[model samples]
Target: MIRTSAAALAFLVAALPATAGERMNLGIGTIFDNDAMGDGDDRWRSGSFAISHFRGPEWRGKLPEAPGSFIEWRFRSEIITPENVSGTAITSDRRYVGVLSAGLHTHFQRNGAEVSLGADIVAIGPQTGLDDFQDAVHDLIGTSEPRSAVNQIGNDIVPTVTLEVGRELALAGNGHVRFRPFVEAQAGIETLVRIGGDFTFGGTGMGAFRMRDVVTGQRIDGVIGTADTGLSFLVGGDIAYVADSFYLPSRLGFDLTETRNRLRAGLQYDGEIASVFYGVTWLGEEFEAQPESQVVGTIAINLNF
Candidate 1:
């Protein structure tokens, strides 16, 4: 996968046009989240690849071009390894998932300043290993019990809207630096199937294992019923150091989530034709019972036309 991305970057750089009007920066990057630490089990080895494209009007000789409009599209995927059965020490296999998204960005400027507003649509592809997990849970819970747990893992289509407001800071050098601190809230619904019909086993002597549908599959709904909402806040800055030949750029950002916090920093060498970046990510908090923190490495290449 890494090699293919590199080749694509080279093709894009070589194909860019010489005329200069509205310039666009297209990037391809990968992010790997290794074995989650807090979660004692090593069932999930997750990674994501993003193909991003951003474009805006030129500002060279123009009056710094107040603020133009831009758009971006991103596609990401994640995979999880199988988990160990509750009572049995046997570990389940692995699973894979893919998500695709496209967003629109609009930048508005007044007095030497810029603010951006963006929205996106996200779609989830088919997932694997969910049925096996459900079956395993059912076998553990037995049919004679009154309550059973159902695992609802399937494909979904979601539309999310985001609003971002940010400003640009003029640097002493020839180039300018832009800082954007934004808050994004996303909410959606999907269908879900419960394995074992809401039953607890072994510890509390609850009797009768019944697998009942809280929500029927016949209902015109996607698996894993919607109603899933996530809120994220990010503060970051992008610096562009313009030189006679090219621009040296860097970005640093921090993201806070309900389960984990992430710190990301990367540097990009932007030439007239293409750009490349190397980044490191540190994950804080234990997903399970482990003591050590998780770390991830990333690389990206961008081509402009």
Candidate 2:
């Protein structure tokens, strides 16, 4: 898998236009998510953090029409654990897993549609040090120790490619209400096909660049801009059909749910010198033996003081 992914990345890099690397500095965006902010139950899909830096020739207030006109370098880390941290027994829950990924992506427009293409080299298992990190956090917070840490998923590297295409439709001439429907496909790590749509009820992010969150699929800003100073609302949902997953090792008899669903809503405030985004997402069952659904919260703040 590692060799294949490397070759795939090489092919992709070779296919880029000559000017892909020549661009000016743009902006940066960051996001953090945790189950603690939701139901306070830190279990599967526990937490994640992501930061992306974008560069281009200039800020055109919208995606450029040419391919590779804008580039984004993204870094992300994630930790997933079983339901009970201290339990040593073999439950039907998912094994502890840690992931760190870095990738390069391009955002562009073609024929009135928005497109993103990227590839990530995803590292999984204890090598990410997430198990130890989680232990330290738990110890500091006086939470239960991760007794089952020794039984986590083995280490592996997977090369994943992701592609998404969508078009934004302005439901209101003033840009108060807009809807964007998209289709996304992935190859590697967890292979799946997804279809979804997002709605914006205000002018917070109009004509701005936004990046989608991996876990919750929430679109967060990718570049700080002269946003309209006001409050905006977001609502979105998606359904995915999974073909395979590395997290659910077939040899271990872990059952993978064929269908997955997610629903999310958020509010954003762009003040004079600061901006804040807060959202909650409801995640449907991922495994057949899983107990129930879970809710997670996400937040992103930028202060330009």
Candidate 3:
């Protein structure tokens, strides 16, 4: 589904005067999260993997307003299971759900604010093959089998649209500290409005375009940075009011928790040849019957050779 025709490729190459095929790759980022990395529990929000790519003609260390200055493609896979995957009987827990999403987003600047707009096709249920994937992984590790896959969420494909607007504030003159405040809106698989802000204490991603993860809300690099190498720390949080969710349908006797909250902190270490990022996030309850909140960890590594 993600194929580029020869004519289209030629058109894009010809459009960029100096960068025909020289500076195509902007950056790539991947995040893997599991409960084993945080809180020591693997109940709700079991695990997820996401990757994103930012590509364009060339990045000039600034967000351009041109229509196609930069393009972002993201893919994600996730699995949600009951509290006990091996249990034979259905407990009063969240139902099993598998999700795979792919989307394309465009980034630009408007009125001194960074603007991101995109749409995704979200597929949910056993069709995503996440149940089988998890089964294989657990079997290899001698973990309990997710028997509840037989009753996982029904199959459905939903189209979701997301939009975010944010502006960075330079708190220190030397670009050592910066703050970004943003507002976001989404409609589709989950309908909600969110407001949040992020703070940076170093120069890890000074001039790079970053993409926010859906589950953890961590900023992963999309466009590689060309700034100084060092260590940087980040802290951010957000609150949202959700109106609907396809994962936990009301028709299935699940009660939705309208207000959702998340808190996260991360650090980045940039070296001459590679960079590493690790972050932990506290995910608030999503349903009324949900137990206490849970913490999840995210990690990413990028190497330049």
Candidate 4:
């Protein structure tokens, strides 16, 4: 996975302990849509990775202000070559799927509102040399859906767990403009419940909650050595209502038909060393022999030294 995320970003810049208001960054991304530019069987091609950690405010009197404690890491890939999903693939899915994640947050202040608490972990599978080159392209085009190979499920290791809560609004008071709203729930093997919101203009305040910049603003006001070179932009969106999604196609077994609203929209740019984002997703209609309706396109870039 890119040499294990470049050796975990050089071991977190060598055992994390550099503080002039520490806040590091690195990101990358891409995604495709239109059923992967039209080749059917719903396709996808994605690549992403990110790493960010912040703990500024000069450790707030030895760590206590909690303005959203942070730690993050991510990786993703959903490539299905042949230049975009096709070329005689005998069903039951999984050509290339990979995901790895880690997220954590913590912010404080109750009665006066400004709360946050979070957790995350996700790991999907498939990537053994692209599943052995897609089993040699399905053994050189040799099978025809043995009922989807006796109903799929086995890209190995699927894990999930998430929990969330957030609220941080700063409408207008020199903090520029801000709003962060959230609600979340998740479970192993894949289950869900989600609610979201985001709106930011300027810097600071974006305590991660799906409207993703993958969380920034020094990871929600942890405050780094005063510097953001000004200029900023953001707009966020989300809407999800999924019941289960164990890699679709009727939980990988077939018998299609499973979709319960999922949408997203985004645009962002945070400067002072590059940060950019663009997202778009719409999915609803996952089967019944594939009834269309699915779109995705995500883009990201971040670099801050």
lDDT tens per residue, model 3, 217-250: 8876666567888888999999998888998888
lDDT of 1 by residue, 116-205 (tens): 334444444334333344345457977221111122124554544333333323232322232223222222221111111111111111
Question: Could you arrange the candidates by TM-score from highest to lowest?
Answer: 2, 3, 1, 4
TM-score of each: 0.45, 0.94, 0.89, 0.28
Model 2 worst lDDT run, 10 consecutive residues:
8-17
Put down candidate 2 lDDT per residue, 1-305, tens digits, no spaces.
Answer: 88877786676666566776677777767789999998789788889999887888667578887666788888999988888767774667789889999888889999999999988899999889988998898899998888777888899999999999999899995888999999999988899999999998998777677789999998877765565788889999999998888888877788878799999999987765556799999999898888899999999875432
What is the descending lDDT order?
Answer: 2, 3, 4, 1
Better of 1 and 4 by lDDT: 4
lDDT by residue (1-305, candidate 4, tens digit) is 43443443454445434442554332222222333322333343222334444433332212333343333333333332222343454454343344445544444445544443434444454432444444564568873322222222345444444555566577885656876677666654446666666666765323322224331111222222233444445544444455665554254554434334444555555554455555555555544444355555555555433
Off by over 4 Å in 1: 1-45, 59-68, 80-97, 107-114, 125-152, 168-259, 286-293
How far residue 9's Cα lies from its native spot in candidate 3, in Å, is 18
lDDT for each candidate structure: 0.31, 0.84, 0.79, 0.43
Clashes of each: 35, 0, 0, 2
Candidate 2 Cα deviation (angstroms), residue 234? 0.3
What is every candidate's alpha-carbon RMSD to the true fold? Answer: 21.0, 2.0, 4.2, 16.8
